[model samples]
Target: MARFTDDNDADAEIRALGEALAMLRRERGLSQAEAGQRLGMTSQGWGLYEAGKRSGLFRPDVQRRLTGALDATPEDLALLVRASSTPSALTQPFKPDGLEMRGRIFEGAPSVERRRLQLSSDELAPWAAAGTVLEYVPGRWPRRDQGCVIEMADGSLRARLYVRSDEVELVVRGAGALLTIEKIPRVQARAVSAVVARLDEG
Candidate 1:
């Protein structure tokens, strides 16, 4: 049994790949400044490559030299190259702050007595989605024929409210069906509020 003693051989393989390329440049006994001259990098920049910092490195040409200098088997060099190029997921911690909150809806409506809502995508299925921020603006008195958002008595839906002279109605455009609330008397028709803007869209 070939017992491996090094615990960090995997990590070392990656570092070895990086160092092997650097060693090839140095085997000519060339100073970093001399290597830098050939590679079009500053001496300090080349050192970052040897240290295995991802940003500063010889890049593609390093592969050419690794084959020559280390006589590294293609399979070995490939393993190192793969390890070097691929980032360790553990090294990058899950940083909530680092995440970008894009498509993030914010309530922009300014109202004195209005409540804002933040609902999940699942909460408002077929209507709103996750990251949907809603600003509940007080409804203006319903106009004759303009589109308005209104709350129902049971508060089942906040839909476009349409008004006729003697009839109150909510026109829901689905299944090619329309709902007319003409049964409710003008005196009893209650308009809770209207949605001024969709917070998610804005």
Candidate 2:
């Protein structure tokens, strides 16, 4: 595994905004297609908002439409906006093999950073709820139909079930959305990690 630390953070900001939109949409149990229909567009159009191809989520009209579609509060959007500047805690030096100790060398290393995420959407409702915390182990990729987090270079992160990969893209299905991303270009992502467990905050 190689460490990705680019001097430019523009891509990072866009990813943050997109991740925010996607998270909010999932929280509300709305798929991109569903949200797009409400907004009078196609799923791809709606996805652009979450992909950071579009911008201004805080604009008056943008907020209105997003809020209407996702049932999100203005404060939620504010928090997402503020997250654009969030420094990633996941950054660590890459060690292809596990840390060398007195005995044996660990593969992929226990040094793999574990990320914790709190659910904020209903897209994966029934199976999961808002405020549920999920733990992910990087380098431990998921198999077919397994839940995992897809990390994108834009800094946007998506939690979906792994489907399959081809030359063009990697496919995944959203747990709550019952939605499939048929083609997520391989270039857009940093890596994928398995979602090993979920923790309830209550």
Scored by TM-score, the top model is 2
Model 2 over residues 11-104: C-alpha lDDT tens digits?
6666677787777665443557767887688999888878877757526688677766765665777566664444341243324487733544
Residue-level lDDT for 95 in candidate 2: 44
lDDT of 1 at 41: 62
Q: Rate the local accuracy (lDDT) of all candidates.
A: 0.46, 0.68
The candidate that achieves the highest lDDT relative to the unseen native structure:
2
In lDDT terms, how accurate is model 1?
0.46
Clashing pairs in 2: 26-123, 27-121, 27-122, 98-109, 123-176, 124-176
* Alpha carbon lDDT at 121, candidate 1: 37
Candidate 2 whole-model C-alpha lDDT, 0 to 1: 0.68
Q: Estimate each model's TM-score.
A: 0.26, 0.43
List the pairs of residues colliding in candidate 1: 121-129, 121-130, 139-194
For candidate 2, the per-residue lDDT at 137 reads 79
